[model samples]
Target: MIEVSKDGGLLTLTLNRPEKANALTAAMLADLEAALAGPPPAALILTGVGKVFSAGADLEEMQAGLGRNPAWERVSAAIAAMPCPTIAALNGTLAGGAMGLALACDMRLAVTGAKFFYPVMRLGFLPQPSDPARLAALIGPARAKMILLAGARIEAEEAQAWGLIERICAPEALMTNAQALMVDALAAKAGHIAAIKALIG
Candidate 1:
């Protein structure tokens, strides 16, 4: 499930199914895709409410071929194209297809205990189309290959060191830190925000 909240210029999209480790379903992916379909906000924070940001696609749904769903690419592409600054506030371990969502964000902030891994090789599924390039851009080809091809589970410290995550914070400080990081973006005019992001790209 997806929980959407807006406070003026800031939009926060939270993955809310704690019972399932916030595993994504087709309907959940549809909700995510729809939520991000409109005009961009000044800033956006993508996170989850449980110990695991997401366990990737739901097992049952994956078996039913949801892994091949185009919605995954659509959601990630929408995030990638956002004019506003986007951050992935990773509350816990990030795995499977869900890695695409974080990879699309402009920056990633993870909790100290969070782990990063995409086990597509082990699971026998290719990651969404844009994920590999985005991932390689952030952490480089060999490291990206380590996760995608060899299934290495990177700890938060290592993730930060390797440029996978920008910062590592205590679980309690995650949201506050994310908000702090957005202060400048939220204060700026929408056009200014977009222009700055474009310049950085």
Candidate 2:
């Protein structure tokens, strides 16, 4: 479940599984890989269609299949490999593997009530490989340690202050403003954006 839309240079991928809190599934991961496996768009925006960004991996499916882990890892890698700037529009909560997806993006915008959560400590599961290092680089060792070690779920305001998100928008203006920001950020500088993104990554 992914809804793809393109307007000018921005390609938006919306996770469309509200029924399951937009949980990340193997098929969804496949779709995401396919979407990113192309010449880069000027900007890519990832968001959820419903109220929650993602509840995490499809636990029920994982119960039936142990193969979901590698696919999920690839999803995060695909997001990171995009040559152009990428943004995560956090309409609601992001849990578990969803954190890696958002962290892989170049920028992140979250609505006021949105949150960031990971259960690595509580669930005793190893996080995606790149996640701990990237998160620590963004927020610092102590704060990142607090989050991953204690399973903290920080809300939007605190998340922004701690470098988890770039900005917090009111619910109604989230997507519109996110798109506008992407357009403004990448206008007439697609090559430069790609160059800098490559350098950074």
Candidate 1 C-alpha lDDT tens digits along 1-201? 799999998999999999999999999999999899877899999999989999999999999999999999999999999999999999999999999999999999999889888988888888888999999999899999999999999999999999999999999999999999999998999989888888999
Q: Candidate 1: which stretches are off by over 4 Å? A: none
Question: Best-fitting candidate, measured by TM-score?
Answer: 1
The TM-score of candidate 2 is 0.92
- Against the reference, the lDDT scores of all candidates come to 0.93, 0.84
Cα lDDT over the full model 1: 0.93
Q: Write the per-residue lDDT of candidate 2 for residues 70-162, one digit (tens) a residue.
A: 866677788888777788999899888778889998889988888788887887677878889879988998898888998888988899999
